[model samples]
Target: MLSPNTTLKQIEILGYLGTKFPNWIGDDSFNNIVDIKLSGSQHCSNLPPLGQLPSLKILHISSFDSVTTVGAEFYGNSSAKKKPFSSLEILIFKNCHYFEALSMSDGQCQELTYLSIYCCRSFVSFPNGGLIAPKLSDLNIYNCPELMWLPEKMTSLSSLKSLTIRSCPLIKAIPEGGLPISLSKLRINYHQLLRIKWNWQTLPNLKNTLSEEGFPTSLSSLSISGCPLLKKIYDTKDSENKEYWRKISHIPHVGGSSERQEEDSFLNMKQAMF
Candidate 1:
């Protein structure tokens, strides 16, 4: 539906409209619509099968309060074998308060390049195993208090280059396996709880050494804020901690800050010690 009724909340509306609208892309219909923005509708139990639209390139959804989980219903056909949203490049979700999980299918969203999630407090998990998105290059997440863990298999996102996480208090560590070696730019702020807990062990002061364990070998840019303890482990003037500094010394840019900002993308994120 090119002109969406802002008041409509029924998931059936799109399917009904599909027959009336004939926009073709590849083997799918309703392909002419490149952008869809849905906001303030809270009654839908699941995200509509927007994934079936092969030509959709940008999707923005906000304030759909009743959608507690993102699962097979979001991906039409429920077949991992068939690529969904074959041409989508940007996907954004904001203020989805009750959103809890997202179950992505294999090869779905393969062409996506940017993804952002904002203020989804109850959101909990992403796809359990790697739902590969080879073209994804940027991912930004903010204020999702319960969504902590990054995908454990970063390698699955082979093209990921920039990552931003701000104000997510519960995420305690990077992906369990480690930051994907492919990550080039990283910005983190207000993950005070997480910065103090990246170490595999939960014990106190047992060496929360990310560089030694599995921080990426290289990054073009790095910024960290509101993580004093983490800064301590890496930024050291003490002779005993020279090794730690030496480990990350090769990075060309390093910045740190104590403040949080409304915008968390690369442009607004200033230099901070990372």
Candidate 2:
């Protein structure tokens, strides 16, 4: 148990294993803690219920070798009365090999703004039900090979601004509803599942001023690269996928290899056909 007298604004636990933080930290004793960083916890199979800390704003957890399957326990005691991570703004998870599954109760992380997940190869499941991060502005997912879908109800995040998906080879498609119109910059790179024919036919019905539900008209910048199959569709010989083509044509920045994109019929032949 941590001393009832203990009080700190920052905590760091590095290169340690079998470490257990005292539950007493959450009993109104450590409300001032703002930053917690844990790295190289190679043999640590479990984590403290730090979510109960009301003032926790930044959390970075990485390199837990023996840990697998994260569930509500990491959030807080199942019977605890308080909301978890209520004041958190930035949450990051990386380099945890065996960690899989993140199931959190609703109304948590209510003030969150930036969420990132990277290098977690074994991670498969995210919070169940639907994700409700109202203030989330930047959501980045990278190097996660098995995550095939984002939350089903992402449109609830009306404040989202920038989204980046990278190095996740198995993610076959974006969420079914497409992205929130609030998004201004979107980037997809080094993805394998997106490589093959992007089944635009399977895209969710997204709304805009011109259509019922198409791509978000508010999007200003778009980028796509390393998706072989999508590129094939872009450079096909006799093009008829205008609906798909028109969707990204207006976006200002769809970054990729200039040489290949210049040869693309989608871009070069637009004038010839018009």
- What RMSD does each model have against the real structure? 8.4, 6.9
For residues 1-274, could you state the per-residue lDDT of candidate 2 as single tens digits?
3364456888887887565555664554688889889889876687767778888999988898777776666777657687788889998888988887776657788888998888888888777765678899999887788777776677677888777777777776656566676665666774443353333332222223333234345445545665556555554355675555565665544445324555353344443433
lDDT of 1 by residue, 5-121 (tens): 333332222212121122322224455666777677646666667777756788888888788887776666765455788888998988999988777767788899998888899
For model 2 the local lDDT of residue 179 reads 64
> Each prediction's TM-score against the native?
0.66, 0.71
Q: At residue 164, what lDDT does model 1 achieve?
A: 84
Best by TM-score: 2
**Model 1 alpha-carbon drift over 4 Å, by segment:** 1-28, 79-82, 190-220, 227-274
Residue 170 in candidate 2 has what lDDT?
A: 70
